[model samples]
Target: MNPPVFKPRLSTSYLIVDDHALVREGIVRVVTNTWPHAHLSHAASLHEANKLLAEPGASFDTVVLDLNLGDSDGIQTLKTLRAAAPMARVAVVSANNDLDLALACLHEGACAFIPKMGSIDHFVRGLQTLASGGTYFPRDLLAQAQQREGAPTGVQPVAAISLTPRQHEVLHLLLQGLTNTLIAQELGISAETVKLHVSAILRSYGVANRVQLLLVCAGQDDSTAPQTH
Candidate 1:
C-alpha cells in the first residue's frame, strides 16, 4: 500500500524570515508543497517581520526564522518575537548547525531547529512535529550532542547538512552520476532549478564539484583541499 499523504493542519499559517531571496524561495516552495493552502508570508529582516506581525489580526501558527539576520542577534530576535507573539511557535532555519545554538533556541521557546542543509525529510518532519505542538531537533544532531555529554551511543552518527526536499532528491540522483538534465527530467523540475540546487548543495557541503561533494558525503574529508570547478 502507498504511504498516506501529509495533510497540513487546516488554516495553518506560516511566516518565513530570511535575507537571501533564493533560500526564502526554497523554503516557500517546500512549505507550499506540504501546506498547499496555508497562509504563507515572508519578511527579509527582523524589523520587517515585526511590522507584519504587529498588524491587527495578524497571527501565524509558526514562524520560520533565519538565525543570522542582517540586523539582529539570533537569540535576541527569538526572544523579541516570542515576546510579541507568545502563542506562535518558532522554527529557526539557519546555516549554523552548532548544537549549542540549537539547544539555546529550544530553551528560548523555539519549537524546531532546522539546519538549512538538512534533508527535505527532516524539514517536513520538523514541521509536522511542530504543527502538532511538539518539539524537534535533528535526530543525528541530537544524538551527537547527547553522546558528547556521555550518553550511550547507538549507530555511528553522520554529520548533518540541510537540503530541501527537492534538493535532496537531486543530490540522490547526482550521487548516481546523473547530469543536471537527467536530474531535471527525473524530478520534473526545470534544469535551471536543478543547477541552482546543485550550487546550493555544493555551498552547503563546502565542495567545489560533484565529485568532491560525493566524496564528502561518503564519509571522506577531502573538502579541505582547494576547490576545482
Candidate 2:
C-alpha cells in the first residue's frame, strides 16, 4: 500500500507581517509548501498591516506576525493587529522565547505563538493547527506557564459549569480562537447573541476573558477568582 498523501483541510488566506525580508520569505515558503493552494499577503510593519487590513474586501484566515517590527514592538503589536483584523487568527512568530511574553500574547488575543528559532517542521505543524481552527502554543512555554504563579484561583473546569447547547457550541469555537464575529457566522446567529453566550461562559468559568478561560481549561491557573453573574 502507498503512504497516504497529506492535504490541508481548508484553503487558508494568510497575512505574514514581519520587518525582516528573509524571515518573511521563510514563513511564506513554509506556508506555501504546507498549503499549496493557500492565499498569501505580506506586511513589513504594523502600519502596513493596518493599511492592508483596512482595505475594502480585506479578509484573511490567519496572520503570521513578528512582535519586533520596526514600527511596533512587544504585545502591543499583536494587540494592534487584533484590533485591525479582529476576525483573523493572529499567530505571533518571534525570536523571543519569554514565557511571560507568550502568555501575554495569548491573553491579548493571539491564537498562537511560534518561536522563530524553532524548526521548519514545528512552524508547519503550528500553521496546520491554526488552519484547522485550532490554537497552537509551544509546549515548553505552556509548561513554564503552568509553573508560574499568576494563574487564577478557584476557577472550575469547563464540565463543571452548566451551559446551554448553543453556549457549548460557542465555547467550542471560542476555544479554537475564533472571534465573536466568526463564531456568530459559524453558528448562524447574531454577533450580539454570540457575545452574550461568551459573557455567560466567562462567568461560568469564573474568568474575565478567553485567555483566562483557556488557562483554566488547560489546568494552568485559577487566580482569576470567580465573578458573580
Candidate 3:
C-alpha cells in the first residue's frame, strides 16, 4: 500500500518579514481579514525570508516587507528583494515616525511605502491597494515630503539635480501637478504618450512618485519645460 502526498494550493500568497510578532501578527490578521481567500505566509528575518523564497514553487504575489528587519535593515533589504524577486511587487511597511528612511525606501525599488502606525482603516486601504496591483504611498507623507523637499530652504545648499531638455519640459508640467490627461491637453499629445514620459521621469530622477519627482526638479533654474504644442 502506498500513501498519497497532499499538494497545497495558493490562489495568491503574501510574504512579510519583520522582527516583531505583534507587527507581523497585526498585518497577517489584517491581510487575512481583508483577503479571506488568500494564502498567507511570513518570516521573521531577512535570512528566513530568503530561505522561504528560495524554495521551489514558493511564490508571493505581494511582499509587505519591513525595511528595518533585525539584521538586514534599511535600503539594503529593498535591494536584496529586488535582486531576488525582480518580478514581484514589493511594498515597504515601515513606522511613520521617520520620513527620511521612507523616502530612501522609495528611492530604491519599492513600488510603494506604507506607514504601519496609522488608523486600521488607513492601513487597510493601503494593503488593499497593494493587493490590487497599485502602489500605496502614504498620502500625508507624500505631501509633507513634497513641501519640505520642494524648497531649497536650507544652509550649505547645493544645486538640485538637473534634467534633460525633454525631461525639463515634462518635469515643469509635473510641478504644476497636472494629470496625464491635462498634460496632454496642454501639450497637444496623446494621453498615453504623457504617461510614457511620466514613467521616464520617475526613473530618471530616482523617485517613487510624481510629487517627489516634480519637487526635486522644480527647484532647478531651467526654462526648457515646454508648454502647449
Backbone clashes under 3 angstroms, per model: 7, 6, 1
Ranking by TM-score: 2, 3, 1
For candidate 1, lDDT tens digit of each residue in 95-146? 8888778767765666567887768776776665544434456766756555
Candidate 3 lands at a TM-score of 0.60
Using lDDT, rank the candidates from best to worst. 2, 1, 3
| Residue range 1-229, candidate 2, lDDT tens digits | 4333222124389999999999889888877877788899999999999999889998887889999999998988888888887767778888998888888887777777788776777777766666655567776666566546344666555345666656767766676567888889988999999999999888877777787666556453222222221
Q: Please identify model 1 stretches exceeding 4 Å from their true place.
A: 1-11, 118-121, 128-134, 147-229
Deviation (Å) of 166 in candidate 2: 3.6
lDDT-better candidate, 1 vs 3: 1
- Which regions of candidate 3 fall more than 4 Å away from where they truly are? 1-11, 148-229
Cα-based TM-score, every candidate:
0.57, 0.71, 0.60
**lDDT for every model?**
0.67, 0.74, 0.65
Answer with 1 or 2, whichever has the higher TM-score. Answer: 2
RMSD of each: 16.9, 8.0, 14.7
TM value for model 2:
0.71
Error of model 3, residue 144, in angstroms = 2.3
Query: Which of the two candidates, 1 or 3, achieves a greater TM-score against the reference?
Result: 3
